[model samples]
Target: MSTPTASRQDPSPATDAWLVIPLYNEAQVIGSVIGAARGTFPHIVAVDDGSRDDSARQAERAGAIVVRHPVNRGQGAALQTGIDYVLDRTNADYIVTFDADGQHSPDDARAMVSAAREEGLGFVLGSRFLEGPSPVGPAKRFILGLAAKVSSRSSGMRMTDAHNGLRVLRRDAAERINLQQDRMAHASEIIRQLAATGLPWREHPVTITYTDYSRAKGQSLWNSINILVDLLFS
Candidate 1:
């Protein structure tokens, strides 16, 4: 993967594809993620979801347009905030969602946007299973990948990574995907909305990091069963 930039000048994103990062207590890696994104895109918004740490301040220091939540909303809510901010404040043609724990690659962001534009795909999901050399453990690789396949089949999408945060959405599609779930279940909700809308969707390969920080903060394998149960029951 290409090295992320520590700081960079402003550069326009492809067709105004704004990058939106939803963060919790990710002060440790938020600055690096923003800096790595650099001038690669013009609008990079970081939504701090009521983190106990100084995540919002660090994101602002890294030159990102930061938004804050008064209370601890979940990741889905934070992402929704960023999406709404870009749609309301910026003339963005596309919106890309990314993780703030340095798990996602900034360079792959452009590729996802390009693919969305070229294929008229309303949503471009970043698929780890479609790519090579993932940092995910074997157990997670089996459970999540299997769940994704099942969900894709149910939703009529041929996706391989439904849980990955690295996704590019067309403006209309982004606006349409109103997340109802505030927690981990939001991932399934988003995909369900996409399937319900019957919007053109595609998946692109992306690299994700599995550092100790990410693994610690990430959802556990046990939670995977809960997510599926939520999807089934709701």
Candidate 2:
């Protein structure tokens, strides 16, 4: 499987994409993730969504501009915050929404950003299922695949994955998107909105390393239930 770590020879992403990471209580792995990402993408914004741990400090120390949410707003909210910050603060052409956990790879991020820039796509979504089987359990994969189907049906865009956290968006597309669902359901909401607005989009094959820490930190079964309920009713 292709690893997601960026190579030194690859064109730097700092000039192309503004990285945004939204995490809550990711103290253990966020530091290293930010440090590694900073090597390729220097302009990074990490949103600490009311984390009680040292997540903000670690990201700050790793050279990320930290944005703090006094209350734990969901990942969607944090991402929007980071995006808004970058749009208002910098003249960035592209915005990359990256997972705060160590699951996402910087190499894949760079490729997606490069793809968006070269192809002139308004949105680039990373898909783990495009190449081969994901590095996760069968049950988890099934659930995620079901969620992808749900998103596809709602959005009218047929794709292999929808809940993937890695994405690159053009400035105009990023500015137009509004994430109403603040929690897990926000993933599907994003797809639905993008499709609704008719953005030029593409999905790129990417890697997701599902470690024990990431697995533990992921949404629980009940959270999944809540997400489905929210998607269905709200």
Which regions of candidate 2 are displaced past 4 Å? 1-9, 219-227
What are the runs in model 1 whose C-alpha is more than 4 Å off?
1-15, 223-226
lDDT of 2 by residue, 6-61 (tens): 22336655686789999799999898999888878989999999999999999998
lDDT of 1: 0.80
Deviation of model 1 at 46, angstroms: 1.0
RMSD (CA, Å), each prediction:
5.3, 3.9
Tens-digit per-residue lDDT, 4-115, candidate 1? 1222222355647888999889999899889988657657989889899989999999989989999998988988899999989988889999889888887788887877
What TM-score would candidate 1 get against the native? 0.89
lDDT of each: 0.80, 0.82
Reference-based lDDT, residue 99, model 1? 88
TM for every model, in the order presented, reads: 0.89, 0.91
Model 1 superposed RMSD (Cα): 5.3
Instruction: State in Å the error of residue 200, model 1.
Output: 1.9
